[model samples]
Target: MHATVSDHRSDVAVLHLRGELDADTAGQLSAALAGLLERPVPRIVVDLTGLKFCDSVGLSAFITSKQVISARGGWLSFAGANPFLAQLMETVGLSRYFAIFPEVDDAIAAAQI
Candidate 1:
């Protein structure tokens, strides 16, 4: 998978991810998210609109990112997940842990609130 980071406003960071999020790309995702946490962004929105697939490794990366953000008193949410990915998260019992939104704007608005 490919990842891009963008600073949105002062306290929020946006991560735009594309391609398949499988084991081969999970490390990159983790590193990218870790780098984002290095700064003091109170909120992070992960945009998965371009993402095609996600595996257990990818899910773990999100979990790790969430843990890091939470430890720093920040929050992380997911946006634009396709139905398949959303189903995977639900099946894995991770939907409750993440603030999943149907749109990026909704995720951002939720974070801002």
Candidate 2:
């Protein structure tokens, strides 16, 4: 998987991810998230529009990042997840932990609030 980050505003960071997020690529996601969390921005929106697949490792990455961000009084959100992945998240009982949006703009706006 590939992770690219951009600043939506002074306080929110947007991470756009593409490709499959599995064991081999989970570390990349983790590192990218870690880098973002290290910055001054406290709100994060992870865009999964281009992501084609995600395994348990990817789920772990998301959960761990949320924990780290929340511990620092930050917030993490998600956007552009496909139906299958969305169902997977709900089935796995992870939907409660994240605010998922249909588009990146919506997520960014919510994070700003």
Candidate 3:
């Protein structure tokens, strides 16, 4: 998987991820998220439209990222998850822990709210 991060605003960081997010790529995601936390941004939005697959490791990375953000009194959300990935998250009872959106704009708006 590949990850790119952009600062949309002073308090929000947008991360665009592409390819598969399995065990091999989960570490990259974790590192990216950790770098984001080092910044002054208070919120994070992960765009997953380009993501084709995700595994348990990927899910763990997401959970870890959320925990990091929450510890800083911030929030982390995901956008553009495909049906398969979405189902996986639901089946794992992680849907409630994350704010999922069908569009990046919606995710950004939700994060700001």
Candidate 4:
């Protein structure tokens, strides 16, 4: 997988991910997320529009990120997940843990960083 980050407004960071997020690529996502953790409230919207697949490792990465950021009063949101992936998250009971949006702007707006 590939992770690219951009600032939205002056506070929110958008992390756009592409390809597959699995064990091999989870580290990249973690690294990208780590860069944004320096912010006081680390509001982040993960753009998943380009992401094609995600395995358990991918899920772990997100979980870890949320844990670290939540400790610092930051929040993590996900956007643009495909329908199948959205359902999968719901089925796995992860939807309640993470804020998932149909689009990036929605996540950013909801987070209101």
The best candidate in terms of TM-score: 2
- Model 1, global lDDT: 0.87
Whole-model alpha-carbon lDDT for candidate 4 = 0.89
Candidate 2 lDDT over 44-92, as tens digits, reads: 9889899989999999988988887888899988899999888988999
Assess the local accuracy of residue 22 in candidate 4 as a C-alpha lDDT between 0 and 100: 89
Q: Determine which window of 10 residues in candidate 4 has minimal summed lDDT.
A: 104-113
TM-score of each: 0.94, 0.94, 0.93, 0.94
The 0-to-1 C-alpha lDDT of every candidate, in the order given, reads 0.87, 0.88, 0.86, 0.89
lDDT of 1 by residue, 13-105 (tens): 889999999999998898888788897745889998999999988998888788888888999888999999889889998888988999988
Clashing pairs in 2: none
Clashes of each: 0, 0, 0, 0
Tell me the lDDT of candidate 2. Answer: 0.88
Error of 4 at 107 (Å): 1.0
lDDT of 4 by residue, 30-72 (tens): 8898889878888888999999999988998888889988998
lDDT string for model 3 (5-45, tens) is: 98776788889999999988888998888888876535888
Question: Cα miss at 45, model 3 (Å)?
Answer: 0.5
